[model samples]
Target: MSDSNKTDFTNPSTFILVGIPGLEVAHVWISIPFCTMYTIVVLGNFIILFIVKTEPSLHMPMYYFLCMLAVTDLVLSTSTLPKMLSIYWFNSREINFSACLTQMHFIHCFSVMESGIFVAMAFDRYVAICHPLRHSTILTNHVVAKIGLALVLRGMMVILPFPFLASQWPYCRTNIIPHLYCEHMAVVNLACGDTRVSSYYGLFVVFCVRGLDVIFIAMSYTQILRAIFSLPTKDARLKALETCSSHLWAILSFYIPGLFSSLTHRFGHNVPLYFHVLIVSVYLLVPPMLNPIIYGVRTKQIQDRLLWLFTHKGI
Candidate 1:
């Protein structure tokens, strides 16, 4: 294939990304939606944080995890959406190499932290449902604090290497990252050196971090299910399942598209640019947009708090 027809797989010293083709015009279509979503994500998560901080009733382990999750979502969305909007609204798609690496690092960090929050939430649910009497004892304030610290440390360990690995490669020519944000793999793929070690390390980290979290979540739900099934009444089972409905939805919304996008990027690079952009946008934006709505509608506490806050504000 001619150079024009070939995908630039080699790393160049500098990259120039002319916004995705056809998307330069399509930015208008996404601008309002993206802005609205960003507003909702930031505001919704802020309210959750505020309520969790101020409300004595929400001082429990579950709410603590919820607060952490809200913080994670806020940071995660901030890590990408601002630059995305800048590119869309102002047509400023250029990003410095160091800036790209920094963005990629935080994106990976917050994403891994979110996974850890999910795992902690699952454990909270398991303790609450499976061993109700001991829930408080098992998930104490100190324990939760420890878990939070561990999550941050673990996420840093997993994601810090990605930027380091990327920095080592000499970028000689093209700097245009096709995607809006500096995705770890996409950035690494631009490196001109032997990326075998980076690729393998990335794969290992992804599976170890995300994969283990998924396993623990699955196990937590399994135990909760068993405990719920042993209860005598249909009403009881329904109520028990209802408690987890929001969490289940959040997990599905966050994980499915993410895994699909990763798979497509790895194996389906031959696909059209539109498909790639569409899948990636969905992976990045949809979860941030949907998370608050799903959790708010499904969790009675959040719903009631949101209602009260709105009523007081008269908006």
Candidate 2:
């Protein structure tokens, strides 16, 4: 074969992303909900940030962590949704290899950061409910700032290898990605060489970020529940448990779908590709949309501030 005719598998200039397999006809219709969800994610998260920033009374450890969660959700959703909507609405599916890597890094980085934020928030709740007297001293402003910085650095350091390992692979087989975005495994799976290192490292990252964080969160909530029950009055116990409901909902919304999607994508070979893609898309989008609402409705301080802001036209 001539040099020009020979396939250049070493590195393709671009990878074509299939928005959703076997759902070409519904792309337009599908874009509607996705666009709506993206809108909600943006507006909702921004609102949370705004409310937390302008209201001096809401300045505390819990709201600080809520702000972190909101920012994480914003980055997490923005990293994937715009391109996905572009693929669905405009049929623009070409993603540069470098850009793909960038998207992959942001998606995973913010995901891990979100997980870390959840753990921090759970610990905040634990301290607030379990040791109400020392809550302020325990989670001081300096401590909260340090926790935020640590979460950022931890996520970046852990996920830094993802794009590096992915980029090191030789994608000689094909430049077509069957999923919506440049998911780490999806991009790595396109490589022609052995992907054991990348696969194993990805799992390691999951364990470091998700597995350990989940354990910490569970432990924190366990101690929290014990503290709530030991309260002297029924009303005190009910009020304390009510405070955790929003956090519980946010945790469930994020981890349950995320875990389900991750498991099905890895082991459920019988599951349809489109089904997996849809699940992942929902997993990413739903949490951002629901988190702010959950916190706004369930947390009294945020609810009061939201009302005041709306009533006063954000004055």
Q: Note the Cα lDDT for every prediction shown.
A: 0.80, 0.90
lDDT of 1 by residue, 50-101 (tens): 8677667889998888888888888888988888888888887777777888
- 1-315 per-residue lDDT for model 2 (tens digits): 233224658787788898899998999999999999889999989989998999999899999999999999999999999899889888999998899999999999999999999999999999999889999999999999999999999989999999998888887767888999999989988898799998888878766669899999999999999999899999999999998999999999988987887678668899999999999988899999999989988988888988887788864
Q: How close is candidate 2 to the true structure, as a TM-score?
A: 0.96
Q: Go through the candidates in order and give the C-alpha RMSD of each one to the true structure.
A: 3.3, 2.2
Model 2 stretches astray by more than 4 angstroms: 1-6
| The 10-residue segment with the lowest total lDDT in model 1 | 1-10
Clashes of 2: 0
